[model samples]
Target: MNIALPALVVFALLLPGFIARSRIKRAERSSLDYSPFGQIVTEAVLWAGGLHLLWLALAALFFGRHVQPTLLLGLMVSDAAAQARSISNLASELSWIAAYFGSLFAFAYGAPALIRAAIIRWRLDRAGAPLSPLLRFHAAPWYYLLTGADFPPGEEPDCIVVSAIVNISGRPWIYMGILDDFFLDPEGRLDRMVLEKVMRRPLDADKQPSTQADEELARFYVVDGDYFVLRYAETVTLNVEYIKLRPAA
Candidate 1:
């Protein structure tokens, strides 16, 4: 019974973290890399020590004068010695239960906020810029690309930006205007983009204004005056050459 109780307590204490790790692994697939061995060892020690201290504090609070550190110390000593005592009679059992459930509850409540904070910190670290409110829920790769740090001169951009050629259903069309907004899938890939002040010109039309033409298009050619949503999957190609043109005086 003593062996069983301590084993159960240990499992309960670690279960929340184990479940979190599993969920992160599943979510990130192989993209998540393992920490260094030294860092892993350090974190393991810190977690074990912190949990043990928390358990001790709970024991002192619950069992008070009856709580004996010797019982807990022996429980940690060896399997044989741990099995020697009857866990049911131990004054600290209630404290163990409280600590176990308390840890689980804390993790459940705080994990989402913690994850958000971590992601924000990581994005800031990688992009070397403050995170935009627009990207609070988006992921790293998207943030990096949007910040223009990932794009260099003469290179194909990772994302479709201001003005571009958007091929939809094999029909080539010129898309003009600001890329005002975008959405990301759970895995952080761009799902859809919203363009504002949008105008479209057929690829074969010679009357089309030069990309640098700042004059407003005739109302007839304006596809969407306010906004248009372009799905990433539906877009066959995006030519960013127009983005290099200087606006007409």
Candidate 2:
């Protein structure tokens, strides 16, 4: 009965903002770890679907419904149907309830992302500069063999800048985040499972040369998550890329 109509409208209104926030977060998170694009997409879809269904159910309750259509049917068969006129009124009331619930659900899921995106987009565009191209590379599977050298020492930058130059120029490359802490084995060699996932192919490394343009970017600071600190380094270099082993001290 066109139940999705209002929900679709609300999603349309709210999607742009979420898209913006999603984009910036993706870029920022890309520095530390390979971006979790698939996971993000799945979460967003599930959130929207759950909210939509819940709202539809609420709207049905808000609008009045036909509790006893059979009474009118019986009266009609007996040539005493005088209350059939109320059927249209009941249907109309039910529709209003459905619409209300759909609108409410749409707003709940969409509002925050939209507002966050608006701010992000403003800061990004007003700076009048472009971010450098993302660097990427593939780490071979065998690098995970080094057992003890897995962790990097001290506070690392939010985006680990690897210095590996790609063989192919102008490819759509991105700085895949650090491969550290990925293989933590909570239950039986969890680290090994993660290592297998990342080792599926070559990982990405950042190789952009420092430039005046980077200096002007306000959003490019390296943030430290563990210590709650922001370390604004002009340039942090990785001597090797695609190695699962920790960097040489």
Candidate 3:
């Protein structure tokens, strides 16, 4: 049908870009709000057109398959009748077209990830590094915030110590622990954090933690769980200490 032809042409143009975007998302570890929908569509169109043009150019040079621009343009504007007339030729070369698109899809999935890996290996994602303006070590801020990736390589923290104040039972409570893991909400905000060896005490129940409190750590009771989950929304205040531990003999 006339309607289906245009749709297929659009699909043929956009599908490879979507494939590449999906791979890039994984490579970059992006959050859900990576880009606006309009920007995504615009980038997809650009990616497809550029990749197709380059592919056609290489094909002409290497395989003598000099695809005409009008061939693609005609497909975009073709009706059911025109497609029917060209059906036999298309069917004859269907396998070659399939192979060609298959290779392009593979390239789409691979090239972005390869580039990202190279950038990371060369430290090009760091601030003041080459291409740092365009490429980052990660698309998620959580990675840098939680892991201290911006720190010098050998000095990066081995652990995160978290202290949080939360009002849950009509009174504020203070909790402290080593951060084990964290989760993100659909909108890419902090959802909850998981803690190990968690300890807690009611606010105003004790003096602030310090060398003085080191003598009275018994004031804080252990949370009897392998991991404690703290919802970010319930927290009134949060503090984190990035700690680097020396190897024990």
Candidate 4:
């Protein structure tokens, strides 16, 4: 038996699980303490096995047929038996094959997002948000930290605002704005951030003493564009404020 045939067979089965794991990680931050690749591989294998088991169950239940074990074992060592059975399966029930593959694609991309939404809706992600800790949500600490959504019902902030001091050249610049968005690198560290309704000024602008007469003097000028992009690496200091807006009467 050629080593390449078995290698290919293993890859084919694991592809969908790899994609699914990637989607899950990409959709949220991963905070694993150990090596994530090993975890991914173990998870991928389990997920692939579960999916295959379910697929086989569905095939037998609805189509009244099953993949021949001879064909499964044969696939690892050579193409002949596997190809022959696969062709017969394809010809006899192309719809089932199509549905099965389509499901793999959906499982890869859609399941993570759907699962997150379900967790949030049931208040499972925030550990029974606004109430008590029924279960803990261990994903996306940045999201939880920024929005304060995990707070009790009315106490949670409606918006999170950020004031940042960024060092530029030899001087420091100050920026104030509503948090527009934030991005994380592959290592799960903050990379950069975007702010809307931004205003900027030199940090030295506030150095002088302020009196009631000087209050009218604006210290910050409105930034010209829609968003102010700041590299987190350049940030000297950051302050976050939670703003709560009263509902309209």
Candidate 5:
């Protein structure tokens, strides 16, 4: 009985850690070349500590006191009958506690993830929002992970284009330009982006264009007259990878 209870506890503690390690492995499968030893150890320690605390809390709350330490000591030194009795009692107590608190833990982890997934789905499904083909897959959620200052609704700040990679005519092209303005459809969804004073780098480019070398391509493309209109649909992939509002000079 003592051996069984300790084994159960050990299994419970390690299950979460194992699941976490599997998820990390899946996420880093493409880019990471080396084993993440530090991350693995950190996650294992964190899961073990968190589960221990949960178990302790459940025991204290339901049983009116902590019992594992005493039970473990008894198991180690007690006689056969005494050890058997202690193990049976401890197993019975933990079974009830695990049944109740395990459900609570599952709900706590699941609810938030479901809520966030719903929110991201709603935003992406809205009409006129910039749609990416990648959004049809698991990568959709990554679109919301934009790095920028928080711009509240109905407030248009002076947004500057730092750099952009645009796929045009079945070929990838990089452009360096200044963001002038943006247009939204009737539903207040982003429709078109206008970039002014644009300079196009060479086709099939892998590296960022040198601003000094491309001085000739630097010319003002007037808004509503000659500015580049990115309609969001014409490209295979569009990433606003970086943006910084150029301060007024």
Candidate 6:
């Protein structure tokens, strides 16, 4: 390993990932802290996989190596071994710095939006209409994290409808909400404690119900779109609860 060359290669290899990891950490510190090992494992796996692909591609392109039948598998094993050693060393020496940068970057990019979404969700909860767990919220003109499926059109909605007006620069652009796949238990049942009502309304679409009762249901609102619109689509469900956030007051 040429000292300078390896150092440069390592920097090139790890700098961007480190920056990205930091950004995610800072932005979602609470979430990240609660879920560091999980996140790190996920990132490590993804990094390992991606690097394996890159290694193969480079070998094929530059070294003219035949992509054998077991090339991918071989790459994965080798990459894993390499990463295990590197991570252990880095954990001892550079883990703190790596974690610091990762957190800073994550906060810079991720925190604002998460904070906005939490506010929106809080407002929606206040308005008595909470969004279902499946719903997503975006940061921007609409600070809420309602589901993307709710708004078919790519228009950004208003956040103030649900909470106090917070000034955000730039035109309100739209992005998909963060997906929490762990919304439901393994048995496909909801945790009642975590579930709260944002908005409640009658289910009037299906009138021919003889067995199951047709009682009114509550659709939890997250943030409001342009003040507040309680219109519910068939596919969208409503439920509400405040996401725990310790944002700067």
User: Which candidate number has the best lDDT?
Assistant: 3
State each candidate's clash count.
0, 16, 0, 0, 0, 34
RMSD of each: 8.1, 18.3, 3.9, 5.4, 12.4, 18.0
TM-score ranking, high to low: 3, 4, 1, 5, 6, 2
Across 2-97, the per-residue lDDT of candidate 1 in tens digits comes to: 446567756665555444443322122234435566754554445545545665576568767334666655565556646456343465467755
TM-score of 3: 0.76
How accurate locally is residue 189 in candidate 4, as Cα lDDT from 0 to 100? 72
Task: Locate the minimum summed-lDDT window of 10 residues in model 2.
Answer: 193-202
lDDT of 3: 0.75
TM-score on alpha carbons, each prediction = 0.52, 0.23, 0.76, 0.66, 0.40, 0.26
| lDDT of each candidate versus the true structure | 0.54, 0.36, 0.75, 0.70, 0.51, 0.36
TM-score of candidate 4 versus the correct structure, residues matched by position: 0.66
Worst window of 10 by summed lDDT in candidate 6: 158-167
Which 10 residues in a row give candidate 1 its minimum summed lDDT?
21-30
Better of 1 and 2 by lDDT: 1
Candidate achieving higher lDDT, 2 or 4: 4
Model 1 off-target regions past 4 Å?
1-7, 16-81, 84-86, 89-96, 111-115, 118-123, 128-139, 147-164, 186-188, 203-212, 215-220, 238-249
Q: Report clash pairs, candidate 3.
A: none
TM-score of 6: 0.26
* lDDT tens per residue, model 5, 120-238: 44544332346423222232232232312223333224445534556766676656555666554543345566777666654544344546644444432223445787764444445
Candidate 6 stretches greater than 4 Å from native = 1-26, 30-32, 36-39, 62-143, 146-150, 163-249
Stretches of candidate 2 off by over 4 Å are: 1-37, 64-106, 109-231, 235-249
Higher-scoring candidate on lDDT, 1 or 5: 1
